[model samples]
Target chain A: MVNAVTTGADAKVSVRNLEIAYGDATALSGVDLDIRENEIFGVIGPANAGKTSFLKALNRMDMFNPEMKVGGDIHFSGRNTRGLRNVYALRRRIGVVFPLPVGLPMNVYDNVALAPRLGGQRNRAELDVIVERCLRRAALWDEVKDRLDTLGSLLSGGQQQRLTIARALSQQPEVLMLDEFSIAVDPVTTMRIEDVLKQLREEMTIILVTNLVQQARRLADRTAFFLDGRCVEIGVTEDLFTGEVRDQRTRDYVEGRFG
Target chain B: MSRSSVTDFDRRNRDWYIDRLVQAVVFIGGISAIVFIIGIFVFITREGFSFIATEFDVSGFFLSQNWRPTSESNPTYGILALVAGTASVTGLAMLVAIPFSLGAAIFIAEFATGRVREVLKILVELLAAIPSVVWGFIGLSIMNPLIIEWFNVPVGLNVLNAGIILGLMAAPIMTSIAEDALKAVPDRYREAAEAMGATRWQVIAKVVLPAAKNGLLGAVLLGVGRGFGETMAVLMATGHSVNIPTSIFDSVRALTATIAAELGETAVGSPHYQALFTIGIFLFAITFVINLTADLIVRGIRNK
Candidate 1:
C-alpha cells in the first residue's frame, strides 16, 4: 500500500515503485520510500536484501553495471535523476561510502582533497583547509596529519575506513549514503564515527545501512527494515524495538529472533 | 591384526616415488635454462676473445663510422654507423608505437565491451602472430614505393621505412602488455573515483593510469627490447648500406644485419669473423639488461 503513496515536496529523495533486477534475477521490487531532508534515516537488512542496490540507484551507479536494470523513478531535489543529461553533476551532489574502504591509490591529503579538486577548487590554501577540516571531522586527522604524503592504501583497515569517510565528507554533499561503514572499523573507532554521523545529520540527509540493529536504535530517527528484496516496514526507530511495529517480521528481526 | 592391514608410516608408496621423480625432472628442466644461457655466453666470449685481446681499439670500434672489414690494403672494424642506424630506427619506432599501442590498450581494456572486446583481443594476438619476414616483405614491396612517392626522396629503404615496419611489428605486443597492466588495476578504484563524480576519462587519467604506471613503463621497455632485437625486418627494410645517416632518407646498416650478411663469407678464425661475434655479445648484453628491467618493473605491480 505504501508503494502507491504520492510524492511529497518536503522529501529530499522520493522513490516510486522502484524495481531493480540483475539479468532476470530480481534484487528489489515494489519498494517505495521517501527520505526527508536533514534526517538520519536507517536501513537494517540481512545480506542480499537489496539495501546496496537502493543506494546505487540513488547515485545512478547502475550505469557501470551492464546487467543491473533499474525500472522506476527516483527524484533527488525535486528532479528526476534518470532524466538528467549529466549524471556526474547529479552524483557530485550526493556522496556514497561503500561497505569496504577504497583508498584511491594516492596519499592521505590527496585522498580527502580529491572530491574538492574534482569540483575545480584549485587554491592550495582553500584545499588545505578543506582537507584538514574533513579529516578532523572523520576523526582521522590526528593520526594521519604527520604523514599526509604517505599512500592512503598503506593505512590500516580502520584508518582507511575513516579516510573513506573523510573523502566522502569533502564533497559537502546534500545527501550522504553509507553502506556498512563500520564492518572493518574497531569498536572505539566505530563509536567515534557514529558521533561524527550524528554531528553531520544537522547539515545533510544521512542514510545509514547496517546489519547492527542497535546502531539503528542509536542513530536513526526513522528506520526501514528490508527483507528478501522488500521493505517490510518503515517506522520510528524506538517503536520498532519497543514492539510497536506494523509487521511481526520487523519485530523478529530487531529482537534477533530471526532475520 | 591382519597381515595386509599392518601399516608402516615410513614406507614410501608408488605415488611418493612418482612425486619424487617429477620433482627431480622439473629441477633439471629449470636448471637447464641457466646452463644453456651460460654456455652460449662462454662460447661467444671464447670466439671473440682473440680480437678483443689483440687488435680491438675501443675508440675506433665505437666512434669510427667506416666499417670496411675486407680491404687487403687497410681493413677496419668500426660499428658506429650500425649503432646509429639501430638507434635511429628503434627511436622512431617508439615514437610511432607508444601512442598507437597505448590508445589501443585503453580501448581494449576500458572502453570496449563483450563481443567488441573479445574480437579486438583476438585480432591483436593475430597481429602479433604474423611473421617478421612477412612484415619485412611488406616494407620492401609496399612501403618503400609509398615513402618515395610521398616524400620525394631518392631512396625509401631507410630509417623511416624500417622504423615504421618495426613499429607496426612491435605495437601489438606493447598493446597486449599495456592492456594487462590497465586490467590489473582493481575495479574498486574506478568505482570509488566514479562515486566521487569523476567522469570516465577523469577516472582513467587520475586513478587508473597512476596505479598502473609501473606496469605501463614495463610494457614500453619491453617494446624497446622487441625493437632492438628484431633482425629480419631491419635487415630487409634498411637499405643495408654502412653509413651514419644524417636524415631519414639516408640508407643505413644495423649490427644484426651486418653479422647476418657477413658471417658466412669470412673464415671462422679471421679477425672480421671474430668482430661480428663481438657485436653479437654487445646485442646479447643490451637485450638482457632491457628484458630484466622490464620483468622487474612488471613484478613491482604484484608487490603493490
Candidate 2:
C-alpha cells in the first residue's frame, strides 16, 4: 500500500490506499488522496464511477449499510480515521451533502440546527448564530431568515438544496463533501451554488462530485477524472482543462468524444 | 389471403388475450367491492337513523349514572354510563398500547438483528391473528385471575381487564403499522442524520420518528378506533355493569355491548327498542368521528 505523509503539512484530509467493496464487487481499490485546507477538490466521472463510494468512505457513512465493506487508512488531522470507531465524531469532522435535497420534515431552522444540537450546543443564542451564519454562508439567509419556522419541505427545490448545504455547514466541519449537489436544480441555481462553494472553500476543505465539467472547471482547484472506478488523471484544474495532452482517455472525456 | 389476415383473425385473437381479460375482471371486481362497502354503510345509516331524534333529554339518558331499561312504568334507558365507560377504558388501553407498540416497532425497525427481528415480527403478526374472542377468553381464564390474585385487585371482571385485553389486541396492529411507516422512510434520511454525528438511538428518536410521525399518528388513531369499537372482548370482560366506571377496577358497560345484549330481548317498536337503536346510531356516529379524526391526522401528516 502507498503511504504519503508530509511533515509540517497541514493537510485537512490524507487518505492512503483506501479500498472499499460492496458485497463481492470492488468499488474502490488502493486509492491515495490528499486534500489541503481551504481547497476545493472535485471528483468528475460518469455514472458507476465510485465517486459517491469514495465520498461515503471518507466519513464512514457506508458503515450503516449492511452490504458495504471498507478497508485501508484514512487520516484526518494526524489521527488515523480508520481507528476512529466513533462514526458520530468522524462525521462531525467531515460533513456531507447528499445528491438529493433531503430537507427534513421539521422547520428550516431545525434542519440547520440539528447537527449542532446533536453535537451538544443547546443554548438559543448559539443556535441562532449558527443557523443564521450558516444560512448566510450558503447564500440563503436573506430568503429564509424571516420564515425560519416554516417547514423545510415547503421550500422550492433550489432553496431546499441551499438549505441542505446550510445544514451541513452548521456543523462547522473541517471538510465538506457534496455528492452531485447541482444535478436536480436549474442552471441559474447551479451557478449560485457554485458561487457558494467557492466562498465555502476559503474556510473548509470541500470535495465535490459532479458530472458537469464546467462546474469543476469553475470551482475546483484540483479536478480528478474517474473512468470505471479508477482515477484516470488528477492535476491542477487549468492543466487538466488546458494542457491535458498526456492521457488520451482524459483528452477523449474532456473533448466529449466519449464519457 | 391467409386465415390470419391482419384485419381479421389477428384482431379477434388479440381481443381474447389473457392480460385484457384479467384487467377487465380486476377493474370490475374492485369497483364492485367499493360499491358493496358503500352500500353497507348506507344501509346501516338508513336503518339506524330513523329512531334517532334531533333533540331530546339525552343529557339524562347519556350522562346518567345508571342504565336500567326495564318493562316497568318508568323505562330507564341511560347510555351515558356505557359511553363514558367505553371512552375511559379505550383511553386507558391507548395509553398502554402506544408506548409498548412504538417501542417494539422502533426495536424491530432500527435495532433488532436478522433472525431476532424476523422472529419478533412473526410473533407480532401472530399476536394480530389471535382472535379478539380468544383474547377475551384469555382475559377471563388467565389475565383476570392473575390480575386479581397476583396484583391483589378488588375484582376480576372490570375496566382494567377489558383495557388489558383491548391493549393486547391493539399492540400488534400499532406495532406493525408503525414498523411499516418507519420502514417507508428513505434510507437517505437516516444516513443524513447519522452523518450529522447522531447516535443510532438519536437518529431513530429524532430523525426517523419525526419523519414517520404521520404514519405513526395514523397507526395510533387506528388503534384507538379499534379499541373504541371493540364489542366482543369488552362485552366478555367488562362485567356488563350499567353504572359509570368510577375507577380502572370498576365494572362497566360499553355502547356496543349494550346494543348487542338488549337487541334480542327488547320489543321492536317500544321506546326501549328505539333507544337501543339510537344507541346503535350513537355508536356508529362515535366511531365515524374517530375514523374521520384519524383520516384528518393522516392527511395533516401528508401536508407536513
Candidate 3:
C-alpha cells in the first residue's frame, strides 16, 4: 500500500519486508518504512512495538547479537545494506542515539573526537574544528567548552545526552536516529532537543522514535504510528494528525482512547 | 483507634527495622574488614622495618652476582643473584602471560558466542583452581625433562622452565581480570568505534584496549606479582644456583625459592636466617610497589 506521489520521493533510507527474530519470538514482522532526506521522521508506538529494533537494524546492530537474526532488504544510498558486510562503514553513514546518554568514560573532547579520529582524520587541528562544530551544533559548546577535559560521566543528564548527540554528529552521518532521545530528560531539556532536531534536519535526515504523540506532532515532518510491530498509518504530520481518520483503531489511538 | 491500624503501622515499621539491621550489619562488617587490613599493614611495616633500613648496601645486593653466605676464609651473602633471577623469570613470564591472556580475554569478551563464552569462562575458572603445588610437580616431572632433552641444556632446572610454569599459572588470572576489564568497556564505545568504520580488530586495538588500558595494566601487574611470589614452582624447576645465569638454560635461584629451600637447613639465629627474612621483606616491598603502581595507572586511566 504505497502512496503514488510520495512512495519513493527522494528517500535516503528504504526498508522493505524487514523481519527480525530472536529465537522463537519475532521483534519485527514484515515492516516497511521510507525515510526522506533532510526530513525529521517520527515513529510513535507503545513499548515493545519494535521501535528500537527498527533503529538498530538500520545500522546493523541486530547482527552484533549472535542470537538475533534479521531477514529483510535495507537500502541506503541505493545500495543493499546486507551486501555491505563492513558494519563499520554502514554505521558511519548512519548514527544512533541510545535511549540513555551512554557517553564514553573519556573527556568530553575525546568523546567528540573519537569517531572522527577512528574514521581516519589524524590532524589535531581538523579534529579540534570538528569537535567544536559538533558540540556547537548539539548546543553543548557553551557549557562544556571550558571543561572539555572533564570526564563525560561527570556531566548532568541532559548535557550528557547532548554530548552523546554531539559525539554522533562528529561522525558526519547522513541519517541520525534518536531512540527515545528525551525519555530520561526533563521537559525543558526536551524542548531544547526538539529545537536541535529542527536545526539538524536542515543538515541531515533525522528519525525520532518516541511514544509521545504530541512530541511527534511538534518535530516531525512526517509521522508513522506503529502498533504491534506494524505501521498503522503514515502520512504528512499535519494530515496524519488533523485529517479525516479511516481505521477505527487508528482513530481510537489518535484520539487517546486507547494505545 | 482500631487494632488493624496499629497492626498495619507495625508491619511498615518492621520492614524499616529489617532494612536498618541489614545496613548496620553490612556497614560494621565492611568497616571492620578495612580496619583489620590496615592494622595488618601497619603491624608488618612496624615489625619488619628495623631490618630493612633504607641505607643497607642495597645496591650490591640488587646488582651483584655472588651467592655464598658461608666460606672458610670469608662469608658474604649478596642477594643480587636471587633478585636478578626473580626479576628475569617474572619478566619473561609476564611477556608470555600478557599476549596469551589478552588474546584469550578479547576472544572471550568480544568474539565468542554466549554458549562458547560460558564454556571458555568455566575453563578459565577451572584453571585457576589447579593447585600451585600441582603445577610445581608438573613442571618438575613433565616440563623439566622436556626442556633438558629438547633444548640440549646443561641444566634442566633453569629460568626458562620456571618462567614457563609461572606463565601458565599467571594466564588464568590475567585472562579473567582482563576479560572483566574488557567487559567493563561500555558497549557504546564499541558502537562508536564501529560507527566510525573501524574493523573489529581496530575497535579493540584503539577504543576497547585504550579504555580498558588501566584495568589491563592492573591485571598484568597482578600476574607479575603472582609470578614473582611463586615459590614452589621456582624451587622445583630452578636448579637453585647462587651464581647469575646468562642464558635461559643456566640454573638460577629466586628469592622465594631460596627462602623455602634454605630455611630448613640454616640455624635460627644465624646471619643466613636474617638474610632470608631480608629477602622476604624485599619480595614484599617489590609486590607493594607493583600493586601501588598498578593502582596509580588504573586511576590515571579512569581520570584521563
Q: Top model by lDDT, which number?
A: 1
Residue B260 lDDT in model 1? Answer: 88
Worst 10 residues of 3 chain B by lDDT: B47-56
Pick out the ten consecutive residues of candidate 1 chain A with the lowest summed lDDT: A1-10
Cα lDDT of model 2 by residue, B1-304, tens digit: 5865557744656557887899999999999998996886776555545455533375776677657778476666667788888987798899889999999999999998789999999999999999888988988888788879976887788888888889989999899989988888888788888888899988988899988988899889989889878988889888888767778888888888888888889787666677777776677677788788878877775565
Candidate of highest TM-score: 1
Query: What is the per-residue lDDT of model 1 for residues B1-304, given as tens digits with 9 covering 90 to 100?
Result: 3567546566799999999999999999999999999999999988998998998989889888889999898999999999999999999899999999999999999999999999999999999999999999998999999999999998899999999999999999999999999999999899999999999998999899999999999999999999889989999999999988899888889888899889999999899999999898888999999999999999999899
If you assessed candidate 1 against the hidden native complex, which CAPRI class would it receive?
Answer: high
lDDT of each: 0.92, 0.84, 0.82
Superior candidate under DockQ, 2 versus 3:
2
Show model 3 residue runs off by greater than 4 Å.
Answer: A1-9, B1-65, B145-152, B288-304
> Which stretches in model 1 have alpha-carbon errors above 4 Å?
A1-5, B1-8
Model 2 reaches what TM-score against the true structure? Answer: 0.91
What clash pairs does model 3 have? none
Q: How far is B295's C-alpha from truth in model 2 (Å)?
A: 2.7
- Chain A only TM-scores, each candidate in turn: 0.97, 0.94, 0.94
Two-chain complex of model 3, DockQ on C-alpha atoms against the true structure = 0.46
The residue-by-residue lDDT of candidate 3 on B159-242, one tens digit each, is 888888889899998999899889988887787567556778878987788789889998998898888888988888877787
| Candidate numbers, best lDDT first, in rank order | 1, 2, 3
